[model samples]
Each structure stands twice: as C-alpha cells, then as structure tokens.
Target: MTTTGPRVEEGYAPVTGGVRMYWRSVGEGGPPLVVVHGGFGVVEMFGDVLERLAAGRRVVAVELQGHGHTADVDRPFTWEAFADDVAALVGSLGPGPADLLGYSLGGGVVLRTAIRSPEAVRRLVVVSAPCRRDGWFPDVRAGQESVSSAGLEWMRRTPLYEAYAAVAPDVDAFPALMDKTGALISGDYDWTDEVRALTLPVLLAYADADGIPPAHAAEFFALLGGGLRDAGWDGSGRPASRLAVLPGRTHYDVFAAPELAPVVDAFLTAGG
Candidate 1:
C-alpha cells in the first residue's frame, strides 16, 4: 500500500506469538523476497523504494506484533519471537525458503530468522543493522536507552508516531510499542559465533554515515569470513557473503535510498 507502482496484495498470516501477523506483497515472478521493517516502522514505511526492490521478483513484507495493521498482543517483544513469526510467514509463502531482507531492527530479526530457521531462508540481506549490541555508536546506544524514559507526549509528536497512528490497529498503543522496543534495544547480545557458523550466503548493507561505524561493519563482514582474503582476480576466493556501504545515506534513510535495490538484487542473483 505504501508503494507507488505495483498493485499491492494484502493478507494475514496465521496467529504467531498471539498476533495474527499482517503481510503484503507486490510485483510478480522471480524469487520471493521477504522484507522486515525497522522499529516503530510499518510496511508503509518502505514507501516507494519497495517498487524498485519488487521489480523482477515478488516482494513480501510483514508488520510485526503491534506495528502497522497487526494488533498488539500481550506478549513481550524479542528478536527471537519476531523471527519466529517472520519465519512462519516465509514458510507460508514458500514452495521453498525465501530470500530475507531487513532494515535496522528488522535487520536483526531476519538475521535471527536465518540463524534459527535456515530451512525457511534462501539468502539473507541485512541493512543498517548490527549483529552485536556494541556495534552501535555510543550516542546511538544512549538514545535507545533513553526511549523508556522519554515522555509519551514528546514521542507522540515524532514522525514515527505519526506513521504508526496512520495504520496501527490501536492508535493508543503507540506508547506500549515504544516501551517494548526500548526493552528490546536494551538487550545485550553477541551473535558473532552464530553468524560465523552460518552456511547460507548473506549480504550486509550499510550507509556510509550510519549509526554503526564502518569499522564495526568491517568487523561484521569479518565474522562472515569476509575481508580476510584476497578474493583473487576471478573472485573465486571471496566469501559468498558480501558487504556494501552506500554513499550519501544514513541509517534513518538507508531503507529508502535509491542505490539499495540494485545492490540487493545483484546479491540475490549472484552466481545464479
């Protein structure tokens, strides 16, 4: 519904984590790509950029618990819980596992999906998301920490709130979503070993000026066995996983950046 070109197809997945997740699709043919949005983000947040990503493929997007058209449930929010719901949705859409993409918080979710339910994922794409809690800049971490303490009136005035109010099942539940997200953000995690153990191909995409530093991005790539080899002239030595740092973008806007779709498409189609 947020896109400009493609005719959107909407539906709801069977109950997961006590919420019947809402999902939508666009485009036709080619491999399916399932996209998950950042925190406080709805399917509509993808806006027109989804049109480009949907080209030559069918793109499926989901609204996590309490976000967008999905009604908030009593359960708490956690990366693993969201991943389970997404994985189930992916399975529901599949004759086989689908390629997965996520932005920021959603990036973390899909990463967990690949790790927890590899059978339901073909390839992975993580945009502006960090695998470890410490990957974020100190200031960014500070901001997440302050979310629970931030006044509701102040948050209600934000664009995030406005967007949520536009499509949320319960408009008054915005504060609850914020509180849950704050708790999710405050969690401490280190997925280095898990990522290192992954057998499926992965793509890590980031903006040049992101909440995570380029050094941390390199560290993440290194975990996937990237950046440690010559990758030879023929590129045979390079790891199938990749790292891309788009110029002229930041974490907040990278999801909609014009350059993102081609990069993701290329990765999804590489060596096919």
Candidate 2:
C-alpha cells in the first residue's frame, strides 16, 4: 500500500490530567468523527485509510497521552484516564455526540468512553479490541504480557518505532511508551457488564483472523443483544448493534483493511 496520509489541520486540546492532547483534522463537514490509532501509533500510521474515511465529513484524529506529537504526562496509563481525556476532547470539539472509531488499544479507550460518556458519543466503531484481556488468544496475550523494556530491544527496527520516531515529541520515550502500554495491556479486565449496558449503536468490526476468537466476537455481539434470534423479512429483528469479520485481516493490519471504511461509514451514516 502507498501509505499516503491525509492533509490535516493540526491542533491541541488541554484535556484531563493536565495533558494537552494533540489532534489533527481532515474534511470540513458536520458532526466530526474521532479516530484513535492503536498503541505506539500516530495518526499518520493509518495513512490513506483515514483520508478515505474523511470522504464527505470531518475526521478528527488524536494522539493520546504520550504517543506521537502528544507528550507523556506524570500519570500512569489507565483506560479510564484515556477515556476521560477522549471524552473531554470530544466535548471540546463541540456539543457533540460524535461518531468514534478506535483500533487496538484505542478500541478499549473508546469502549470506556462510550460507557462513561454515552451522551458525548453518537455511534461507535471498535476495531480489533477485546472487551476483556482474555478475549485475546493466549499467544497474543502472551506477547502483550511479556512486553518489557528489557525484552523489546528488537523493536527498535520495527515500524512501531519508526512511526513514533517520525513525529513524537520525545523520540527517546519510545521505551517508556512501550513500558506503559505493556503494563496497561498486561492488566486483567472484563468489561462484559459495561459493554452489555451500552445503549449507543456499536459496530464491532474485526479481522476474521484476529487474535480475538470468533466465538468471543459472537459472545460480544450477543451481549449487545445481537445474534440471539433471526431478523425477520424486513430485518427488524436484527439487533441495533452490528458485527463484522472482514476476511484476510489480522489484528496487526486490520486497521487499514479496505473493507473497514465502508462498513464503518455505512454504520455512521445509517444512524442518521
């Protein structure tokens, strides 16, 4: 893929926890969509995929707490903290109930945002994120668990490092980013109750080959009141929530999957 990112108007919003979160905007239409990248990622990492999502409406992409142009703060990484920051930024943008899309670590953050501040969100798209830590395959969970500064020396040569280095305020903090993210993902969590209570429309889209098992996805859908019974002739029986497993995608590259934008766009527009 050509990896051409969108041309954005960049800015920052001083959100919770004394952090000035960095944000980039594309398009100029109403009711913006907020896009959050995976851990150790910057906005540009989504490349043209984000641009494509911005087709007719605005897309606001954020660099959370310590990633990319956003500098790290004194606080440790926590889902609630990040979610509050995101919620604050969403309100700052306008009197919004904006559409939200998040990938990987971002997915967890937005999930909390939708839970904690449902009024601030209109529709949600969760890509490659698990409600519980164990929702991930044991091997993937092992990788997340085993991450440590000492154990990640080899990552200096990977795209994760290069992407951060390109625009991070403190490039050397890559290790710290890894450390915090490692600790964050390594923690135990089960958000089933919270997810089951969400009243907003959610699109639980993932790669068919994702680290999260298909059974887990079905369980998540069922929790959202989906897949329990048949949709009648007019599809009225289908749950408000939607589930998609895009073929040929894995957790690693599903963010930029070609099939992603269409479903997400359809879900967002369909809400109107």
Candidate 3:
C-alpha cells in the first residue's frame, strides 16, 4: 500500500432528519467518491486503500450513525434509515451525483441508497455485502442469528473495539451500537428485485472466501444481467456491471487489500 498522499480533511455533515454524519476527505481532482465503511468500522478501517484512491480522486469516507465519530440516534438501526442518511450527506456535499463505494454493512446501505435515491448516486460499488439474508454462508447466517449485545465484552480485545475507543464520541455506547447492529443483521431481507431494476452501472467486488457463498455472488451477477449470456465478439451483450473476486482474502480483509483500489478505480472511471 502506498503511504504517501495529501493531508486528509475531516468534518461533519449535518444530515437531514437529525444526524451529524462525520466524514474524512482526501486527495484532489477527478470525480468525488463517497465511501461508506462496514459495521463497527471507522474511516481508518479502509486505511491504505482510502489513501491510495484519494491520490487520483477525491475520497469522502463517511461514518454512519453509531459508528466511528458519528453518535447513535434514537431511531432504530435499519438499512433504509442508514441509506437515507447517506443520501442526505451526499446532497449536502454539493449538487450532481457522486460515486459510492461501501463494504459489508455499508455495502447494503449504499445499495439501498441507490435503489431509494438513484439520482444521488452516479456509480455503485458493493464489497462483501449480500443483497439477501440467505446469501451468506450457512455458518455466517447462523452466527449472525446468535450474536447479541453480550458479545461486546468478548469484542473488547478486538481491533475494532480498540479503533472505536480511540475515536468514537461515546465509547460507553459500544454495547448499544452492538445491539442495534445485531438486530439489523439478524433481520430477514431480500432485495433481488430492486437490484435487478437498478439502471446505474454496478460493481460487486468481494473476496473469494467472503462470508457470502461464491455461488451466491454469481447469482447476484446474474441478477445484474451478467453470467446469463455470452458477450459476443464486440461485448455488446454484457451489462454495465462487473464482478471481482480478490484472491487469498476473506470478508475481514478484502476492503483493505492492496489490489482493491485499482479495480474500483478502473470500474468507476470506465464510465456508463
């Protein structure tokens, strides 16, 4: 990962409907890329990848409600609510749509944002997030079902906890965030039909060993008009969509991989 880059600019965007979303901006020139980090993730979670991407384009990494510097609101933690928060943040940034990239929980949030307010998103990238509840591997699904706020004590030793402690506005609210996230993940959901109708170009990037099954990734690609027919010599039959399975990585490490930035850059710059 490249270590050299411009200084990062950090600030909070007052999102409509009662939330002050925190964001970090880096780099200059090119189109703006709004990054949404996964659950329990802060801007630092993206680390080098965020820095690298910022080298060529502006990278706005946002902290969703209850995550990172953003404090939790009274509203229930639902994907739809988070999506709305992101859309409002993007709008507050400026006019015109911005490219969006999200990982895991953030991935689901970005997808929902695209569906709910397509005009706010110019390009979409979803990394290691499943569109439906059952898309996860059996073990992952089972684990999500059993997770609870009590796990907060067990997670205290983890890097995520440490990171949160360093920057979270109220470290004492960790347990509450965990409970809300647990409820959100454990809930049932399926957005296959909505995804199929998305007109914007989409990229589904994941680790080969992601929590989601490899077959399910292919199923998602098919839903986006990929894997169903040959592209022909001119490649006209292919949809404006892509799938990338990074090697030797898992859901935990895919977003931080050195190879991710370039793939995402190429796809987003490819244009519609």
TM-score per model over all chains: 0.96, 0.96, 0.96
Report every candidate's CA lDDT.
0.89, 0.89, 0.91
Candidate 1 C-alpha lDDT tens digits along 8-124: 799999757677999889987656899999998888777776788887888988889989889989999998899999989987885888999999999999999999999999899
User: What is every candidate's alpha-carbon RMSD to the true fold?
Assistant: 2.6, 2.9, 2.3
Model 2 misplaced stretches (Cα beyond 4 Å): 1-7
Mark the 10 consecutive residues where model 1 has the least summed lDDT: 1-10
Candidate 3, residues 109-181: lDDT per residue as tens digits?
Answer: 9999999999999999999998899999889988887666789878899999999899988999999988899
User: What is the lDDT for 89 in model 1?
Assistant: 92
Candidate 1 residue 233 C-alpha distance from true site, Å: 1.8
- Backbone clash total for model 1 is 0
Off by over 4 Å in 1: 1-5
- Please report the TM-score between candidate 1 and the true structure: 0.96
Count clashing residue pairs in model 3. 0
